[model samples]
Target: MSKATTSKARILAAATAIAVEHGPKQLTLDNVAKKCGLSKGGLMHHFSSKEALLKSMTENMLHKLEEHGELLKTRHSDALTITNVIRTKKFINEIIGMNEAKILLVAAIENRELLSSVKAAMLEQKEAIMSEPKSEMATLLMLAADGLAFQELLGISPFDENERNQIGDKLIDMAIALEGDLHE
Candidate 1:
């Protein structure tokens, strides 16, 4: 990787951990720089401001989501199945727990305006889901994914991995049945 990219990754990693562990209020330039082994100037070189850092973190999640969507299209030959959606949802849940999602929440509290772009992208994704033939069911499935992810994020999710997988399978079965009816 290029030097700038490498540096940015390390910096963001440190920042994310700080935000999650100590709260976003503690994610200061000095803290990030110290944690990531960069000077304040170095961190600032990549992200000029705290808002810029937050924006990059938000962009990172959106980029990954977009990339995952492309992979879904390619894997299913441009047909994103309910099965694929459920699987992706599972993966997304993991990401939300482990990564920039904490920072996104921080950003929400720190600056709501930083999320306008994410809002637009998510609306586009929602529109795509809504455009499916089994619109209501598909929307429900999508919303369920969000619900599942949020519950986990909030430490309130009750399902173990096995249970979660079972639930996914059930969702896929129901979705496929709805889709089949749409075709009939």
Candidate 2:
């Protein structure tokens, strides 16, 4: 990567780490700069303000989700299969573990306006799902995935890894059965 790109990535990493560690309220350009081993001026060159940095972080996360959705679309032509639902859960789990999802949650709590882009993206996803042949099934799967992620994001998930995996397997089986019924 080029110097600017590297620096921006580092800055974002620092910001995300700080948000996860200290909460979004503690995230500041100076702290990010220090974590990135850059001067405040250097950080400013990349992110002009705290709002800008947070906005960038949110956008970056949404972009990742969009990319994952695209990959799912390619992998599952139906776009609402049991395998795809499981994959969505797995993707959300990965994001939660990475602390990126925490950043978005924190950002939303800190400033609702910061999540405008995310809301828009979700709306688009909803519309796409609604247009699918199995719209109800797709919506249900999406809601389940979101619920799992939300529980993790809120640190309220009662299921351990094994239990969670078991639950996921059950959900996948149900989805497959539902899909079978749809074609019958």
Candidate number of the best TM-score: 2
- Indicate the worst ten consecutive residues by lDDT in candidate 1: 75-84
Candidate 1 deviates by what RMSD?
2.4
Per-candidate clash tally = 0, 0
Q: The CA-based lDDT of model 1 is what?
A: 0.76
Model 2 lDDT, full chain set: 0.77
Cα lDDT of all candidates, in order? 0.76, 0.77
* RMSD of candidates 1 onward, in order: 2.4, 2.3
Between which residue pairs do clashes occur in model 2?
none
The true-versus-predicted C-alpha distance at residue 48 of model 1, in Å, is 1.1
